[model samples]
Target chain A: MIITSKKAIMFVLSKIEGAVLMAKRGMLIVLSGPSGVGKGTVRKALFEDPEVDFNYSISMTTRNPREGEKNGVDYYFVSKEQFEENIKNGEMLEYAKYVDNYYGTPLNYVNEQLNAGHDVFLEVEVNGALQVRANCPDGVFIFLTPPDIKELRSRLVGRGTDDLEVINKRIQKASKEIRMMQNYDYAIVNDKIKNAVEQIKDIVKSERLKVNRVMPDYLDSLGDEI
Target chain B: MIITSKKAIMFVLSKIEGAVLMAKRGMLIVLSGPSGVGKGTVRKALFEDPEVDFNYSISMTTRNPREGEKNGVDYYFVSKEQFEENIKNGEMLEYAKYVDNYYGTPLNYVNEQLNAGHDVFLEVEVNGALQVRANCPDGVFIFLTPPDIKELRSRLVGRGTDDLEVINKRIQKASKEIRMMQNYDYAIVNDKIKNAVEQIKDIVKSERLKVNRVMPDYLDSLGDEI
Candidate 1:
C-alpha cells in the first residue's frame, strides 16, 4: 500500500512537470527602424489590434511627463539621479539621453514579465536596439525598413520643416541605419502598417513553435518515458 | 563616348543582378509524423487553403495506377525497371520499396521546381523523411505530433479494424516514431486540422523571412550601396 501511494505521488509530480514545461518563457520582440520609417505607428497598430497579444514595456524616463500622460502607464517618471543609479546598478536594459533627459527600458520589469511567461514588446531607436541586443542576445530583433530609398527620402522630406541640406543629412542618416538591418534577425518592409503587423504576428507565432525554444523542456518532460 | 556607353551597360547589368537576387531559391518543406498522427489530413487541408502557396511534389511510383488516377497528376507512374534504374543513378531524393512496388521522390523534378523559385512540399513516411533529410539537410522538416499518448493510442485503435493485439503493436510502432520527432526543426501538435494548418502557414512565412536564407543575396544586391 505504501509503494502504491508513492507511485501515485510520483505520477502526479510528473504530470505537474509536464504542465510546467508547456509554459515556456516568453520572447522579447524588439521593433526598430530608421528615422521616418514608421516603427512607432506600426507598433501602435499592433498593440491596438485585438489579435496581437504582448505586454508593452513602458520606458522609464527622466523627462517631465506631458499633459494626459500618467506615471507607470505612459512612462515610469524618474529623476535623473535615480535613473543614473539604476543604470549604475545594471537595471537598465537599454537607455539613451536626449536633450539632457534620460529615456530607458527597465531590466527588472522586462525580466519579471518574461519570467511569468508573458512576451514583452519594446519599440526603440536603431542604436538603442543595438544596445538591447548586446544585453539580450536572444531577443527577436526586427528591423523595419521603408519600401524604398525614394519613399524613405520623401517621408523625411514630407515633414516640410527641414531645409534641403537638413533633408539630405537626414537621408544619409537613414541610409546608415538601413545598413544596420544586416544585424537583425528579420527585416520587415514598412509599406503598409497592417501588412507589417501581420508579418510580425506570424513571426511571433513561428518563434514560439521553434524547436530549440520548446524542445528542451519537452525532452525533460518525456524523461525516460520512451 | 565609349566609356559612357560602357558605364551605361554596367548599370543595366547591376540592375539585373539586383533583380536576380530578389528572386531567392525556394525551400523544400518536408511534413512527416508517426502513423495515425493525421499528417495527411493536415497537409491536404493546408493545400486546400488558398493562403498556403507551395508547389506539391508529385511522387514517382511503380505501383499499379488505381482507377481514374491520371498520370503526372496524382503521381508519376513509372515502370519498376525505370524506377530502379533512376535509383541506381542517384536520381531519387528518397525512395522506399513497399509491397514489392517502388515509390520515390524524383531529385530532378524537386530541383527544377526549387531552382525556379517555387517552394516544394513533400509528405512522406517517417523513415522516408529521414532519407530525405540525409539528402537535403536544408529542408524545413516539420513533425506533426498527436496531442498526447492517450490520443495517439485511441487514434490507432479508432480504426476499428484491428484487434487488441494488432492495436497494441501499432501503438508501440507509433511510440518509436514519436521519438524521432526530435530530429525535426518544428513539432506541431495535431489537435485540430485547422489550427495545425495555420501554424504551418506561419512557419512558411517566417521561414521565407529568415535572415540566413535571404541575407547573402540581399547583401550582394546592395553592392557597396550602403
Candidate 2:
C-alpha cells in the first residue's frame, strides 16, 4: 500500500539489507604491512587458493610501468596529470607521494566489486588504510607482520637489490608501522604462509556470521515476525 | 632494580596480561535461547566433538535433589538460607528466582576454570546472560535460536507435558528475547546441530588470534623489538 520513488525504494532496501540476510554487499578487507614483510607473497598465495573469493584492487600509479607489467591489470598506469586531476576531483580513496611518483586506490573498482557481493582486498599503506577506514568504517583492516625484523631485513636483502641506504630506510619505516599495529582489527604473523592465510580466511568467514549481518527477511519469515 | 610487593607485582602482571598473550585466561562462552531452542542437545553435541575444549558450569540452586540428580554434577543443591547468604556476600555472579527456588552461578568456579586455561559454558536466561556480560565483559555471548517460532512451538508441545497456557508464556518470553538479539556478539540459526557447533568453534578459534592478544615476548623476541 506504499508508493515510493526508486531512490526511496533503494534506501528502504538497504535498511532491510542491514537487518535481513538477503543478498548483502561483500566485505572490504584492507591489508597493510611493513616493507619486505611478505605482503606480496601472502597475497599471491591467497590468490592461488581456490577457497577464498576475493578480488585484489588494482591501484592507480603515476610511475611508468616496468617491463612485463601490464597496464590496468598490474597497475592502472595513469599520467601524473590525470592522477592529480582525480585527486583534485575527490576521486582517489587515498593517495600518497612516493620517491617521485604518486600511488593511490581508485574509488570505483573497489566499490563495484563490493556492490556485487564480492570481497575486495587492498594492499595499502597504514596512512591510506586509515583513510579508507574513515571512508568505509565497516571494512576489516588486517596488519600483516613478518616473523621478525631480521627476517624482513634478510628478505629485503634476499631480493638482491636495493643498496644499504634503501634497506635501512625500509627497516625504519617497518618499525614505525609495526608500532601502529594495535589500531588494526587483526594482526597476522607471517612466519608460516599457510598459517597466516588460514587465520585471515577464518577471520573473514567468522565476520560474515556476525549478528550485524542478520537478515530481517529470515527473521520476519520465521512465523509472524516474532 | 625497583623492588615491589607481591600485590604490586600482581597488579603489574594483570596490566601486562591485557597487552601480551603470555598465558591467556580461557574464554567464557555464554549460551542462551528459548526453552525449546535445543540448547542442551546442541551443547551435548559440542561437548562430544573432541575438537572443542570446554567444561560446563555447575550452577547453584535452592531446589531439592530431583531423583538421580547428583549433588555437585547435576546442580549444587543448597538451602534457601545458604543461597541468600551467597547472594548477600556477592558470590553469585548472576541468579534468578523461578517457581520460588533460586538458581545462580557462583563467581569462583568459572574464574578458576578460565584462569586454568579451560573454556567454560554457561546456559542462562537472557537477563542472567546480560548480567554475566556486565561481570565478564570479555566473555563471548552466543544466542542460540531455533530455525523458526513454529518449530519452537512444536518442540515445546512435543515435550508432552506443558499445556497451552505454559507454552504460550514460554513463546512470548522467547519472542522478547529474539528481539534483543542485537546485543549478542553472534546469532546462530539452529537448523543443523553440527553446523551450529562448527560455527561456535570457528568463532572461538578466530578470537584467539585477535590483534589485542599479541604476545609481548613474541614481539620483543622478534629481532630487536621492531
Candidate 3:
C-alpha cells in the first residue's frame, strides 16, 4: 500500500511539474501586412491597450537612431559591423537591409522572453515576416488586410503622389503583398483598429486553448499514471 | 478602354458574389466530453448568453416525451422504428442507444441550417461526437475537461454512489474519455461555466477568422483580377 501511495504521489508531482513547464513556455505572435494596410498602427494600438499582455520584441538595427530614440527601448542600436557579425553567426531571427542599413529581430532576446513565459510580439514588413516564418514556423502568423482591394488601391493613390505610373506600381506591390495572405494562419481586415485588436485578442485566447498546444504536456505527464 | 472597364466591372461583381456566398455558409461546432463532466451545464450557459450566435441543434430521440417535453422544441421524439429507419438510410449524422432508447442528430436539419448561414451547435456524447467527426470533419470539436484528474475522480466519487467498484469503473471510463481529447481541436477545462463560455466564444471568433476558411473564396474571386 505504501509503495502504491508513493508511486501515486510521484505521478502527481510530475504532472504538476509538467503543467508548470508548459505554462512557462510563451507563444510567439507575428503581425504583418501590406505596406499601407496599417500594420504599424494596429500593432501600436494593441500595445497601448492595457489589456494586451505581450512583450514587444525590440529589434536591432544598424541605422542611425532618430532623435528621441532610446537604445534598448526603441531599438537596440548597433554598429553595422556588429549587426553583420550577428547575422553571420545566425543570432538574428530575421533581417532586411534598406538604404544601406540593416534591421533585424534578434533570436536571443525572443528566446529568452519566450522561455520566461512572456508572449513575444513582432510587427514586421511582409518580407521580414516571411523570414521570421521560415525561422519559426510554429509562431502564430496574422496577416492584416485592408477592407477591400478597392480600398487598398485608393490608399496607394491617396499617398500624396499624383504620379499615375507611381500609383500603379504601388498598387501592384500591394496586390502582391495581399496575395501573401495565403501563407498566414489568420487574416483580420483592418476596417477599424479596435475591431482588429479585439479579433487578435480573441485569436490569442483561442490559440491558448487549443488542444494540440495544451494536451501534449498532459499526455507526457500522464504517462503510466492511469 | 471600354473593354477594360467592362472586365473590371465583371471582376468586382464576381468578387462580391463570392463574398456573399462565403458569408452564407455557417460553421458546425460540436461540444462533447465525458458523461459526467458537465457538458450540459456549460452548453446551457453558452446558449443563455445573448452574445452567442449559434443555433442549438435539437436532437431526435426514440423515447417517451417526459413532462412538458415538446415534440419539436425539446426533442424530435420519434418511434424506435422510425429512428432505426433514419439510421439505416444514413440520415442521422450521429446516433447512439442508451438505456434502450435511440438518440441521434439529424443531418438534414443541420445541413439546411448551415446552408442558410446559421452556425449549428451540437452537444453529444464522445462516441456520438466521433460519429459526427466522421461525417463532418470540418466541424469545430471542443472537448470539455475537468480541471484535473483528481477533480474528476472526486466528482465520480461524490455522485452518491458508495460502491467502490462502481466508482473505480466510472473513473476508468472518465480517463478513457479524457484521453480521447486528442481527437478534438480544442479543450476547455470546465472549471467554471462562465470561463468556459468565454473561451468557447473566443474560439468561435478565431475560427471564423482562420485564413483557410476565409481566403479560399477570396482567391477564387480574385482569379484574374490581380
Candidate 4:
C-alpha cells in the first residue's frame, strides 16, 4: 500500500510537469459576413483586444488591388497561370472569381501560421468560406450579420458612396448572404462593434481549451513516471 | 440584373425573419475533478456570476444523509432497493458504489433542465463522467485539477478528518483521477476559485454560439417575412 501511494504521487507530479512543457496548437478562425457588416472595423478591434493574439491570413489575388494596396501585404499578387497551378496542386483553401479577378487562400501560409502556434484569421466571401469549411472542418467558422433587415438597410444607405439603386442592390445581395449563417460555427449580430469583437475573442479562448487539442506526449509522460 | 438582385434580397429577408421565432436548446456541461480541487467553491462562485445561467444537477445517492444534509437539495436520498430499481430501469446517467454507498446522476432531471433551456452542470467521478460521455457526446466535459500535487496533498491533509494513512489513500485515488483529465473537454488549474468560475463562464458563452446550436425555426421565420 505504501509503495502504491508513492507511485501515485510520482505519477501526479509528472502530469503537471509534462503539461508545462507541451506546446499548444493554434486555432484556425475563418470569418465571413455580408457587406456593411463592418468586417474591417471588427478585425481592427480584434487586433487591439488585450487577451488575443491573431495572425491575419493574406489571400493571393490575380486581380490588381486598387490604389494604396501593397503586394504581399494587402495580398500576395500572383499570375492567373500560377493561381491555376495552385488550384491543381490542392494548395488553395478556397478560391473565387469576381469581376475577372481570382482571390483565394494559399494553404502553405495558413498551415505555416497554424503550425507556428499563431491563430490564423481568414475573412472570405460566403462561397469561399464554404470551400475552406470543406478543407478545415475543425476551423472555427464565424458569420457576422446585422440584427435585422431594417438595420442592414440603414447601414447600406448610410454608406453614402452607393446610390439608392446601388444600395438597394447591395442589401438584396446581403439578404441572400445572411442565410449562409446556418453553415457557420458561430453567428455574431454586429449590433455593437465592441461587443462583437469581444464575442469573437471569447470564442478564441474557449477553442484553445478543447480536449481534442490536448497533447498525447504530455499524457503519455504520466504513465512513464509511474 | 435588376430582377435577380430583387429576388436575392427577398430570399435573404425571409431567412432572417424565420430565425426570430426559433427557440435555442440549452447546453449540457459535465464537470469532474480530483478531491480537494474545490468543486463546491467553484460551483458557488459560478452560480453567483451575473452572466451565467446554471442549473446544478442534483445527484441521487443510496447513502444516509449526514448532519444538516437535505433531500432533493444536497442529494435525492433513496433506499438501496430503489436505487437498484433505477439502475434496472436505466434511469441513471452514471452510478458507482463506494464504501457501501450508491451515488449517481439521474438522467430525467438533467434532460428536463436541458429541455427547459437551462445549462446543466454535472459533477461526477472520472468513470461516471465517461458513462455520461457515452450517453451524451454533445455534453461539454470539464476537469479541474490543482495547480500542483503538493497543493493537493496539503488540502487533503488539511481536511483534519483523515489520518496519514487515509490521506495517503485519498492522494493515491486523486492521482488516478488526475490522469483521467486527458479525456475531459477542458482542464482548469484551480489555484484560485474566482478564475476557475470565469473560465467556465467563458466556456458557456462560447458553447452557446456553436453553429450546431442555431435555431432552424428562427432561420425559417426569416423567409416568412419575404
Point to the candidate with the largest lDDT: 3
By TM-score, rank the candidates, best first: 3, 1, 2, 4
Of the pair 1 and 2, which is ahead by lDDT? 1
Off by over 4 Å in 1: A1-14, A17-22, A149-175, B1-18, B149-175, B224-226
TM per candidate comes to 0.82, 0.74, 0.87, 0.72
Interface RMSD of each: 6.9, 11.4, 4.1, 5.9
Best by TM-score: 3
DockQ for candidate 1, please give it: 0.33
Range of the 10 consecutive residues with the lowest summed lDDT in candidate 2 chain B: B1-10
**What local lDDT does model 1 show for residue A184?**
88
Indicate the docking level reached by candidate 2: acceptable
Q: Is the docking of candidate 4 incorrect, acceptable, medium or high quality?
A: acceptable
| Candidate 1 chain B: worst-modelled 10 consecutive residues by lDDT | B217-226
| lDDT of candidates 1 onward, in order | 0.79, 0.76, 0.82, 0.76
Tell me the tens digit of each residue's lDDT in model 3 across B1-226: 5456445545665665666565557899999998888998998899999999989999999999999999998799999999999999989999999999999899999999999988999999999999999988989999998665556554554454445456456556666766889989999998889999999999999999988877765565444555
DockQ, ranked from best to worst = 3, 1, 2, 4
**How far off is residue A2 in model 2, in Å?**
25
Q: Model 1: per-residue lDDT, tens digit, A76-160?
A: 9999999999999999999999899998899998999898889999998887899999988888888897554445444544555
lDDT of model number 2 = 0.76
Comparing 3 with 4 on DockQ, the higher-scoring candidate is: 3
Pairs in steric clash, model 3 = none
